[model samples]
Target chain A: MSKQVHRTLSESQVTAISEELNEPDWLRELRLDALQSLDELEFPDVIQTPGRTWTDLSKLDFEALVDPEGALEQKERVAPEGVEVLSFAEALEAHESLVREHFGSVVDPQENYLTALQTALFTTGTVIYVPEGVEAQAATIRTTMAGQSLFNYTLIIAEQSSSVTILERQETADEGDFDERYYSGIVELVAGENSYVQYGSLQDLTENTYNYGLKRADTDTYATANWIDCNVGSRLTKTSVETVLSGEASESQIVGAFYGHDDQHFDVDARVWHENEHTTADLVTRGVIDDEARSVYEGVQDVGRDAWNTSSYQRENTLMLSDESEADASPKLIINNHDTEASHSATVGQVDAEDLFYMKSRGVDEHLAKNMLVSGFFVPVLEEIEVEELREDLNGRIQDRLAQRTA
Target chain B: MAQLEIKNLHAKVNEDGGEEILNGVDLVVNSGEIHALMGPNGSGKSTTAKVIAGHPAYEVTDGQVLIHLDDEEFGDEEVPEELQTWELLDLEPNERAALGVFLGFQYPAEIEGVTMVNFLRTALNAKLEEREELFEGDESEDDEDDEAGYETSPMEGAADEGEIGVAEFQQLLKEKMEQLDMDEAFAQRYLNAGFSGGEKKQNEVLQAAILEPSVAVLDEIDSGLDIDRLQDVATGINALRDEQGAGILQITHYQRILDYVEPDHVHIMLDGEVVMSGDADLSVKLEEKGYDWVREEVYGTA
Candidate 1:
């Protein structure tokens, strides 16, 4: 229809997508404004030492990778009572005021270049709203991308005293001639006072794809937010999960995992900010890489000056299955308040031979024992996943990856 | 009867050009008997146990470790070479385990995520599969496979008749935990994670009880244990020796654990070689006289 739109974007395409979806004038303006911010915003910061810069994102030519016209359809899902779950477009149409109030409030759409790009091009997503004092369970969705590119956003709003569990999964649909597709997704969650929100997602796209994701949540007074983000597929992935304890005595737990094999590279980051007193945060991440694969992890726990009596702990471990593979971890604790209790630990090493030997001596096959240990390494974080199906799905995918590595 | 015979075994570390640790250490333990290997630090008492376990870190330069299994002692799992005795050197650690050889570690490795119940189930199922008694079920496993069809047979070895399901595994774990005097909640914890020294030893005994190995090599099973826990764990070891009639090769630097387990025979090892052998009194003598007299008696040094 329009010269088979290729890997570039213009203001016209953004306006056209908005019109195709029948979006309100305010949304169109938001998209166009995000488009304007792209020229000024830079990609997520990568850790740099004197000799090397980890996870180079500058090489990602967004113009060449972003197929602005290609977007996947969001699957419909059933929701619990007192909870409203709808496709992003449907939510915008039926609950425009509600959508406008919470959108881009928790996660700044113009925070980084990737965020700006996502805000400008995302055409498919889901919106979940749990009303005050309603406990909603089991809201799940799976997005299978079949096109050349995909950009999606998920917004979750939990009202005061409400509890909700949301699980999301993403993967490529089929093996197409265009092996190098692009996928970008962003999640914004707002937990109201005393509300509990749990968001878990696993991305296992084809190895020929490039993936980018930013999931951030903000918690109100005495609220809790938990995130489980796992990645096992994709040629290159740059994903980040952040939580801001904006409410006093709020709690947040970020549990993350990734497995990379072949030439796949994973740039994973988990950060937590303590903005209020007596807030608590726990960040745990584990990864395993094999066969020339590489992974870089950065975990940050920041306690603001006024956020006294805050407790935060961060732990990150990466296991290299092959000598050819590489892994790096940087866990930092920035505490501005003297009364805060903060600690961070990062370790990168090969599989523990003693642990393996112990399992093997117990009559487990060496290959299977190694698989168990690798799977076991992810347990501390996996235990944080409250959704049983998502936990099992993530585990099955990890076992699949380990089996492939063995083969 | 089941027996583990170490014949003039000579072994060395597999790394760094193989530093010799076990030198011509000959030993034997038959079913329904407990033999304590007593020695000072670096005397290779523990090395003998590891060498018999086929630890990957050690390579045997000469001699052999042979496990003789009788139909009365071990179930009907076809013995190789058409003989009841199988040499241990060629088998992997797990294979050795399937053949009814268990190694009780001195310092058990702490593994996360793998609960005690799950690990015990897998290990017991591995033993069952080796004996061709495991239930042949693939439905639960197939649900985990993707459309591309990846097979993750947890207990892999010859074909299996079946795998113990969850409920059955829990029942089995409960019985073993009770038998070992372990609390019910202990089975729910990650394998050896944050376990105390005595708890680790007790866990090893619990694994041995569940797997039902014919011969167990205990390497310093009493290390760091207090008098109460040493007696508690030794009682479990005694049950394995009496209830299953399994052979016990108790390797230790101190003889305190032997007080409760009670060895039928005690052997003193000095400088990677057995210097003297006798009844349980040998341990008391070694404790009183220490290794200097043994070195003087054997190498004319003291």
Candidate 2:
């Protein structure tokens, strides 16, 4: 048998990954350019900022990051027959011109270091395209890491008048050393006029693994995008949900839930920009932190100049169970125009002592009481989920996390 | 037999003005009796109930709250010296609830995430735990470990069974709502959210019937109810004493509710203390004779 392969995020690795998928030249160039820029771009000072934390990203070993090539090679798990779940290189070779035209055009690289690096060197990811006026049930991508940094991507384009839901999940089943394993990914969604796109991400990396990712979407006139993010893992993680309503009468609703335990550090930053008239957006993030874990939530809703009659609201609430657990939330609204209604509310607190006491007084143990409060914390978001199976899965994952923390 | 007693309860609110709300109010409520406290607004009727329920806003300056359960009296006196504050404040609203004290809030707090079902289960479990400690004593709790190799004792099993199941609990809510002339569908709604005045009062009565507190303090339970809703609430409260044998403390400003509920004992409260008390007729007498008689009798001037 051949030796087990270990891969790093390097120039040749990107080339090899692209070649493995037989990608075209332009796509390969994009990967190389992204890799080269990764070395030059400085990771932003996320910590010094009001809500950001200075997590030690330098300690992460990119050299030992395993590729898990076979992880995304399966055809049976193909996300819809028409959609492609291949590496960036494969997309370049098979649909070069298509990838080039739509890849970095939606999200600019100069926006941030993470966005630029993600735009260039995203080796293993998927591309989904729903042709004009043809609505598909959903496009799903499941990536499994066998002890490695399994960075994935999902690029969805809902053509004029079409609608699609994209569900991406990251999980691992490796018995190998997990202390050094990590995953970072980015997904971009572009919905054309009169189109509807709903994107959901479920993260369940190993307890020792660290995950950082970003999700950004842009909606055209008369279009809508709904984002539902459920994060239930990672020792240290940061995610950003960004949206730009560029088309008139466009709207977006972003909702998410993050449950963490132990020494987990989970950060959720949501940004919504209204650039057109009559556009509206709302974001609601609910989270639960237990044990020694910590959660940070920062949300910004901005109504751009001349984007009149735009209305936006954002709310973030977190429940901290244990004394050591900490939660921080900052919600800011910026309106450049006067004819806009922009509002935000944030609350960071512990479980209701009276509620806890009420449950305990009924003979429920302390552990069960905590679980009930946790369940209550997530019930609002879970009820908002349209899909029943996915909702059930999220509920199960939340319960599992609670069990691990109490255990 | 369970009995809750209050003696010379003196309490105050640390407002900017240093107002003393309850000034040496004395009363005795046996195991099964309905006591109606009537007076105008700000007459210290609600303060008395809040002090007994351990509300932090009110400080009990001097008083002894004795709770008798199964022939044994447990209060601040029986508790250890190290546990004085624990026996009082640390016990929490739920702990007091487990010990058979329930407050039907004059204004119920609206909580977003907690559902009525889950909230009830938690409270039921706490009450069961307190009941277990009361029955098993030390030897019985220790025997649980020896027998099952688990922490749960025999009393726990019976408590578990005695506690209503989910379906049965839903049915109970339905029955109680129907008895109160409320819509059965209201059970699924959030507790106390968007409730009108009469609805809130009726909801309190419904909770009292369901929880069956040893001492039920209905603080201003008649302030906002229409005539029909008032009658329904009164009927539901009367069932609490007639069926479940729970002691009731009906705190109200107007005697309108007493006309329907008919208190066994009626007490008149002045600035911060009870000035006069008598049988059911005192409620009508207070309405007819008014505060003039109370002022003349208690303060020696009308």
Candidate 3:
């Protein structure tokens, strides 16, 4: 692989990535359209942040990071029966007719960097489609990211009255691991009328990797989506997760937790927009920061004027372990409808001194006391994750991180 | 040979040497003996309790605190390093608690997330593990039967199956709470959170009763309690002493609790030390003459 620089999102770049993956004309057209949208749209003005520099594209080299085109690559990637997993290139060729229906529906190319990579140069992606009224026996699709500095798109659509659970785990083992690579990705989830969808993402990128991700879900006509995100890796990560209730009696639960140590910088921005009547949403996000690590979480629960009886609540809490560590929590709620109920709460501080004192008064040493307090801080978020294995794994990783900081 | 001895104890609130609060307090509380320290407000009774519990705000300028468990002596340089001495004069609060010392705070903080069951189970298991290690091999058949009893119950099956279960501990806690007349439902809620003053005091007593420390220090348990609730707390304390053999160090400004619980000895704290000692009749005398008379006659106060 050459350490060549890939500059600009042009037809050539799109063709290079598309041709390398052997993507069909439809996927190529989608990529080109997404890239055009990315070039035409402007960045959002939600917060005051520094502009994105070109150095952030170090991980998207076409020749070095991507698989060759039309290499039977999708056929080699296997998943459980009835739970299909195929790359965007394969799906664009084999199921090209249905590609237009699901691709890029949740995250528009106009919305920041979500679709820009796909628009410019998309090598591969995982497309998950659950047929109407089909329910998963267990967590169905387990998507694995194995390459270094990889950029992937995951599009999941649960048809009317269908239910499914998707768990995505990103890992790199060996020479292919790009320590300083950048991973920019997006996930689009849509639940049709009376459907239920649960998507869980575990991002444990290498210390040298920088990750930027955006995920959104649209619930229509009593549909429900439970999105659980656990971020325990990467040097710097900026993520946005949202759920839009677009139908009457639509509901969603968004649970997110991030544990960072060392010099890691992580930011999570989430928004839940209730665009229809009788919609409801629940959001709880927690972060534990140690050493010189910094974490910022910004969340908003917006209830529109047409959304009557809309109930929503957002809570963001951060526990800082070291004197040098920093955490910023801002949970905002914008309510345009007077009849709707919306509440937001944000807390940033060390563990309660009284709590520490109480635990200490019971024979638990200072270190164990802090551990117990930190564990309790994440209990609610962890409990929201229904999968036992994933929950325990998350807890173990958090405990290990805490131990390292204390050591 | 259970004894809690305080010798020439002195402490101040501020690190920069503020006013001397507990000045040369000398006292000894032995097993089966309930000693009540009676004094007026700011007489250093509460400070003595806090100092013994290893409150960080206070610095021990002089003196030592010795809590002897059976034949083992704590807080002494003479004890061997492997003997597990608390060094109460310099120990942290948890270390003191682990050393069989318990203090019922006058105002226990309402911890939000720590449930009563979780806190009590952790404290109990720590003590249980310590005792198990100490009393290995010489364990009694009754103790074995109790362990087997827990082994037989399907309730402990969850724990035996590898999950961190608290069913056995919850059962023990329920029985203890029943003794304290505390609602069993309260045990499922957050520890002392949203509890009323009387309920909070009862909670403290409940924990003391459950943990069954070698030495129990109750500060102002009688304050703000009605006669009925006072009698309930007194009954719970009496039960704990009779069953657990815990030495009671009751710090109260009123003689009302002594009327029901019946302390074996009463000490009057004037400045920081015990200024006067007498039998239970002293409580009656203090009730009749009041703290004013004691301050005037004992400390030469006008």
| Top-scoring candidate (DockQ) | 1
**Candidate numbers, best DockQ first, in rank order:** 1, 3, 2
**Model 3, span A277-307: residue lDDT tens:** 9998999898888888888788989888899
Native contacts present in each candidate (fraction): 0.59, 0.26, 0.26
Candidate 2, DockQ to 2 decimals? 0.23
Give the winner by lDDT: 2 or 3.
3
Q: Where is model 2 chain A poorest over a 10-residue stretch in terms of lDDT?
A: A1-10
Worst 10 contiguous positions by lDDT, candidate 2 chain B: B146-155
Choose the strongest candidate by TM-score: 1
Task: Give the C-alpha miss distance for residue A186 in model 2, angstroms.
Answer: 0.5
**Candidate 2 RMSD to the real structure:** 6.4
Which residue ranges in model 2 land beyond 4 Å of their true spot? Answer: A1-10, A44-94, A109-111, A116-121, A352-373, A402-407, B10-25, B39-43, B56-62, B69-92, B121-130, B137-163, B270-275, B288-296, B299-302
DockQ of 3: 0.24
Query: What does the lDDT read for residue B220 in candidate 1?
Result: 89
Order candidates by lDDT, high to low. 1, 3, 2
Q: Give the docking tier of candidate 2.
A: incorrect
Q: What is the TM-score ranking, best to worst?
A: 1, 2, 3
Tens-place lDDT per residue, model 1, B21-100, is 88899888998899998888898987888778778788899999998887555555444444567788887888788878
